[model samples]
Target chain A: MENPPVTDFATDWDHTDPAWVHDPYPIWDDLRQRCPVAHTDRYGGAWFPATHAGVSAVAQDTEHFTSRTVVLGNGRPLEDAPPAPIGVAPPITSDPPFHTIARRLILPAFAPGPVRALEPRVRELCRRLLDDLGDATEFDAATQYAQFIPPGVIVRMLGFPEADEDMFRDFIHVVLEGVNHPVEERIEEFAPIEAYITAQIEDHRAHPRDDLTSYLLGVEVGGQPLAPEHVFGTIILVLIAGIDTTWSAIGSALWHLASHPDDLARLREDPDLMPIAIEEFLRFYAPVTMARLVKRDVEFLGCPMREDDWVLLGFPAANRDPAVFPDADRFVIDRLENRHLAFGLGIHRCAGSNLARMEMRVALEEFLARYPHVELTDPEAVTWSQGQVRGPRRLPVRVASA
Target chain B: MKVTIDAARCQGHGRCFNLAPDVFGFDELGNGVVLVASPPDDRAERLARLAQVNCPEHAIDIEE
Candidate 1:
């Protein structure tokens, strides 16, 4: 196969640049048009697929694109990361048979019935949060609503002791910070998280309860019960997955809706559109930008990838791919036949997608119902967090009084 | 149509049950099982197909 033109892959991503963090879509679009399959030789040798098909192709081809413990950051692999089985890749980062077993073990706990059962509670929480916003003309949606709901639901689901919610939140921030922090600073940031999760595992083991942590502690994978580090790893994964992804989606969706009054009004006028609207929002604003390692040498979109190459799957870019999504840049809530890679594709796809969808749906529904004429206090001033997980740091909005 | 779940293969990702709870259900172990093998109508069948397709484990099979 003829090789695609080699573009310079060594562009440095300035995460500290506030402008890039606020909206990276323009840069992504430029890359997709200019260098669809480009390599960026920073934060390790990684390849970025700027187009929709390129990203999706790598994400779906698990055989060619494998996920191993090696995908874990520069730190000691989760197995040796202090918290025994908790950080180990029995499931999330594992491939195939082992991945299947670990995923099955946790599946029942997150099943729809249980998730649906939590809807009323979720809506109630959202309402209460919004209620506190009161007639305040302006408030940051991320802290007020987006940030709180996911952690609240995740803590309840994981059976984390209510007292340690703050600890968990802190751990999540620490992990996020560590993802971009220099190697020198990561050790310090990761230590507290490891210690916290380790203690939680011990507590769950001694005082078993009807929670996910307790169940994971008792359940054996690959014959022996999961190690403490595996449990911690899984918990950390779930916490990060649950909190950041959902929080980002909520933040982005809220920002989008607030900016687009017509779209918000359409949903308000006809609540039936909310379901499809949620999917459209997810597609238009993919919260997570993931990276998968090429397991073997393979050619994708006429570009060659060798083993150990990091293929960064830009979900937002895929969702916005003009070829896949007509008028991809425009947000059409009723856009039919929309199959987005926001939650990813194939086996490694997001396990908590259902819950994520439900959270977005409920939050949007409640927000629309509560404040029909809300507008961004200053759309240009709203900003987003940088790193692999993308979302607004603060989404300020003002609700017109009833 | 018959619905089968590979208990061993299933990670209990819960996508199937979440999509079509009426046709699929989980056992005490959190493993998936057919709650209704034969649906009462086309609507139920449509949902059952959705549940089967959405199963990330590919655990649900509907043989027509």
Candidate 2:
């Protein structure tokens, strides 16, 4: 869906706008300076908090905002969707009280210990991907390398077919990037995803395996099997949330390195710098800006918000807030005092953060090790994905050696 | 100095454990726990302070 170019983002902001999609940092920076909280009548009336304080306040405030529908669309979410506290995606879409219960059930799976156990597998996947490029001098890094890493790992985790990776990418695009489509169109677009998830759940039931999908089906809360919706929601959440977000992170970090040779050289010189560089990459190119539906009409950050209003929680923007970080706009490779809200803040913080970080670190380490002398073939040719998750969709780079 | 993590504020970000492995470790749920409640030396103290400052949730507290 092509949104009309945004003239004055303060009053009429559209995240899907071409200008914002290509590069939103400037738009967010402009909004931060002019109006800390920008309101727009689009998306059935929504508010955008540009400043770190405003974003942090709304992210931490459950009373005023509802997580029922984190993804904003033209249609009112509650019209046909489930009520607050238990939305389509549990934990992420579930509000507090209930949010904790749902979160705890799956937290252990993504806990540092469990996530660390997958490092070797993730590193192997990265190596395989790099090896596949095999003596290629020029290749698309985003699609060829970065994009394949997360789907490979997630498919293995979910016990899904390796062939379904392409389909997963399509489903993510429909759910995330196709926000501006009409409600009817949106429902039609979502039909395949719904059908696919249902079929996967049924299959998992028939053939139990040591995978996350089976675990979710078997796990109980309060000594009772999880509700069908709970199991389904959590499975869908893991698949959708885990894939594109990390893929984007890996892609963006590579894109940055391809563009900035000095940073790449420094990373090559200091192997220990990978961990710090990864954090800096997350802070600078942080993808994934979540949305929240206002519970009731209330004045927040001095803005008069109405019931069911969409709050485009911009964590990516918050990461770039100058008041929060010194030289916020500049990417510091060895940034020490960094507390960027890339995974977000509060209870709804990303559950797959550990896995995401591990994938990113391994992806970069392997990529640079394989193709140390890499640069953009055509910087202008690179394309960034639109909507909440941002990253290079097509990165054309020339590698000097294998 | 005494180091601690406010369990209420710590959402298991793992920053403490990642930054200062000696002073902090993660629980089963991955939330940070003070391994050495009182930093034994200046090195541990520096690491604890580093974790405190880098914690996005501000969950770490050091009483000097």
Q: Which stretches of candidate 2 lie over 4 Å from their true place?
A: none
Please write out the lDDT profile of model 2 over residues A139-228, one tens digit for every residue.
Answer: 999899998899888998889899999999889889888888888888899888888888999999999999999998898878998878
Question: DockQ, in order, for the candidates?
Answer: 0.19, 0.80
Could you tell me which 10 consecutive residues in candidate 1 chain A have the lowest summed lDDT? Answer: A1-10
Which segments of model 1 are wrong by more than 4 Å? A1-20, A69-90, A296-301, B1-64
Against the native chain B, each candidate's TM-score is: 0.82, 0.95
lDDT of 1 by residue, A1-402 (tens): 111223343254433234446666776777778777766544455677778777767776768875654232343233344332222544567777566677777766666667788999899999998898877878888878888889889988778766666676677766664565655676677788777778878888888988888888889755898765567767877887788889889988888888888897888888987866877888888887776677677777777777776776777878888887788888898875565778776666677876898999998888878888878888777767666678887788887756
What TM-score, to 2 decimals, does candidate 1 have? 0.83
